[model samples]
Target: MIRLSRCAWPGERGAAAGVRRPKAAYNRGMSRNGRIIVAMSGGVDSSVAACLLKEQGYECIGVFLRVGAAPAAATDESGTQSCEVPAAADAGAAPRPRLRHGCCSATDAIDARAVAGRLGIRFYALNFEADFERIIDYFVDEYAAARTPNPCVMCNVHLKFGKLLRYADAMDAEFIATGHYARIRRDAAGNATLARARNLAKDQSYVLFGVQRSALPRCVFPLGEFEDKRHVRALAAGLGLRVHDKPDSQEICFVPDNDYKELLRRRRPEALRAGDIRDTSGRVVGRHEGVANFTIGQRRSLGIALGRPVYVTSLNVVSNTVTIGERDDLLAGGLVAQRVNWLTDPPARGCDVATDIKIRHMHTPAAGRIRRRDDEAVEVRFDEPQSAVTPGQAAVFYQGEDCLGGGWIQEAR
Candidate 1:
């Protein structure tokens, strides 16, 4: 076990290595008040987080999470059998796989440590590789099955909120912090609420919907207050952190190379079986490489060139057919989602309150009416028909910038 503990005193690099100290603000409450651990991914956002915590007079430590199997530096030279030459001399090496985007590796761990050293913070790289594989691997599998699985939501809920919180407690830390661009505030009722970040363009509350109510109190997001990325970069530069100018990771951390198909091919080759491309009436129009490679509203690289343009309307894993239709046929007036998480008490069914709902993170919110469905889903009737209301996508509901709550879209009609 990694013990998964936080660090006390940013400049005090050996606390985790067993150093005790005097009673400063960093050591307040001794056993009660613990250190703050910033999740540093060798990125600028998290680098600044540790800097801000130290400036606030709190004990802080920086940690990078390594989430994949360690890569072979050059190649695997192990031979299966021995020969007269002992196989060492004649054995050919296996070429290493190209490192993909997202998640920390051994290479990134070295960079994170350097950044921590520059910021005068204690640093360590924790191995969360198995947890990431368990969560993110399943996420890719679900998407291959035509379900929109939000790995970040699961990572925030289970790994960050669940496992990391546990790790904080084990280390006797008071709270865990991240570089997320969402604000956390207490409402009049004293309930912790998730709100949009000052930087509207970088707001991340959508993927954080899975955060448990109990975990909200122990979490802090420092970057949420800064409305501009420029300010964040400036803050890091002022602190002289090494990652001050490091490019922001815009893709899902695990799929950094933007090659999801390759990830699926490596993780779940069985799920990549060939499927059919079907019309709305179930008539086979063409053959598809696999349903995993397609998403609703996709048009290009479809490998089919009809005189008129066509778009993927739905995916059926059982039949292994990706159904296609014309643009107008993709519109849907309503949808339903499951596994709803509400920031407030669940909304009243049939309450025609004016609100904005975003079906996907990249999508702009549109006005909608929420009504109760027979099951654990709600009916969202968009003011104007929306396109490609695919199943398995999340539908996040918001009142202005406040995240009201949301659910997974189970159906669109």
Candidate 2:
């Protein structure tokens, strides 16, 4: 059974504190449109999303996913400050509270509850800690295998859209909405197509490539039509929402201290064994700590100096070695992706589908041609060689602003 914790407002003390309410309490006094569950993260973007949906006559139920452990103290109204220490911090110095900039913390949950109360909406904090741990395990496993993983993309695929959709169904809700800066446009035949938001700079279509195609019609993105974050904040401020100036979540929620290496050290120390750092010609230039400490295209803290700069070109888990080479070695003309997911119809095997490919979240979509290798795999040939085609990162495909599909990078060829 799915675990959940209901957040009650001040006026709902009686029912929320222990008084039982009827199951149909949520359905009574509904708005003109159907109910929509907003994934409120206690930020300006999600706050405005809830406000807009309410104004559009939809019964908005605000929900927050409690992903992390509760902090020692609650956060301020802005949800920007937190008291926490890094796992690798110096023990001699007085423990100072570091600025917590990640989402789904205790402070974030409180902020989300406050927003829901302000809007007079039914609020629920679902305990997703158990589900989130799986993502953390996936991160450790990927790094242990010498590959970089995108946990946010996987979170969207598995939790936000995956588990949350199930919750929506249980609640008898019509749609699940979020603050993601991506759009879904339906054609004349009611076929939903995912596209980039009006704000290209904040477009999050890359991370959303794994959303199940069938769920597109039921998904809603309120911030998709806005020009930028400024407008969203303004809307929140106008609505009297206290989180108008809240800072955007920066680091991974699970890695509050921004020290993934320390986390790996604790969780998978055996994977970080000492290994040989080899040059392109298989010559051991120096010794290193572990392959997990490095990623493709990284140049700093290499622990060896050959009087010339070198980048991590590849990692071998079987041999426990890190390969370094010139900058040119990081560029790749093609990549093979596994577990491919297509929002549109699957391209025929051996037929090249010309499209733009994004190797990483921040990467510019480069011109490329993707050909289906099998039912679950595809090969992408870049029009021009791209840099740092790291394995385990997503390779999202797009045609213009419409996101066609994507898959996890298996290897850069």
Candidate 3:
């Protein structure tokens, strides 16, 4: 039922900017005859997303995104172990080439098809290989180069929330929906703001911090209000989606088998060269396989012996050095962030707006104040020094559950 060739579509996959929005038909709290396109990932969350939209009376279509640049032939054999879903049964099952993990492989597409069949909706698989290379491949490269890269944030900005929104426009759909555990609500001013999901443990608003301000109104996250995974699984099982019991994918989507270093070696071997592990005094305490293999505050992989435990303080990609220091040295009073996107208008200069700042996805939000700097970056001064303020990671801002927007951390002061 699918083409065997690599190239299919002649044009780019994402939606073109400046396209006019289609007329929306739904009234508040009522079903709309408007069409909705839900991104189905062959998992319970998204599978239930499609079902919920249809239940709400929206004309629904299910889409599976095909990503990664490796030839489908190569991935056919190798992809099953890492794929979140089972491989689609095709004639060439024996030659199942291992595909790099975390993308739409043969299995995810097939599982998505089954869900669509159950829902009685139109299903289509669109290839987004080139975009994935640009967004995810470069992400891994940066990390291997000793810089922390947030691929999920990049995917949300460029692929899922960005490109998918565009595709919905081309299909004349009123809105694009996903299974992410984040909520979108319009405030009293009619401003679309991202909010933490009801399920705090599974809240994914941090990764979605980079969603463009203009695209906020056209997006929907059905799983945001469902606080528990058990309820979602129960709903899925009740709805008869085969992915009801499928384990949630916890690895980076483009990474093969969740091995970041292995993916780096396959793509860019030069990045894996050994580098010096230095201390605060610049003394070479030891040698490391690569600076990229370490991250800020990482203590497990130093392979160096200090009288007391030491932590990774910094990774200087230019010098190819990993700096280790005492854990106390990792604390910082502030950080400088680039590519800042504010959901509301930019705050005034020197404005001490009290907010919560999250340096990484799992880190608890810290009280902080954001001040605009001239170089298109924001200076975030934490009320208390936070640990492991890693560069190249995102520092997302929030006002309670509302997403105020965020920026990429360039440095932690």
lDDT of 1 by residue, 242-275 (tens): 4556666656777756778888888877778787
Report the lDDT tens digits of candidate 2 across residue range 169-204: 777776889989988877867788889888788999
Instruction: State which candidate, 1 or 3, has the greater lDDT.
Output: 3
Per-residue alpha-carbon lDDT of candidate 3 for residues 288-376, written as tens digits (9 for 90 to 100): 88777888999986788887999999998888999989989999999999989987677876666788999999999999888887766
In TM-score terms, candidate 1 sits at 0.81
TM-score of every prediction relative to native: 0.81, 0.85, 0.84
Best by TM-score: 2
lDDT of 3 at 154: 88
Best by lDDT: 2
Report the C-alpha displacement of residue 33, candidate 3, in angstroms: 4.9
In model 3, the worst 10-residue window by lDDT is 3-12
Q: Which runs of model 3 end up more than 4 angstroms from their true locations?
A: 1-33, 69-103
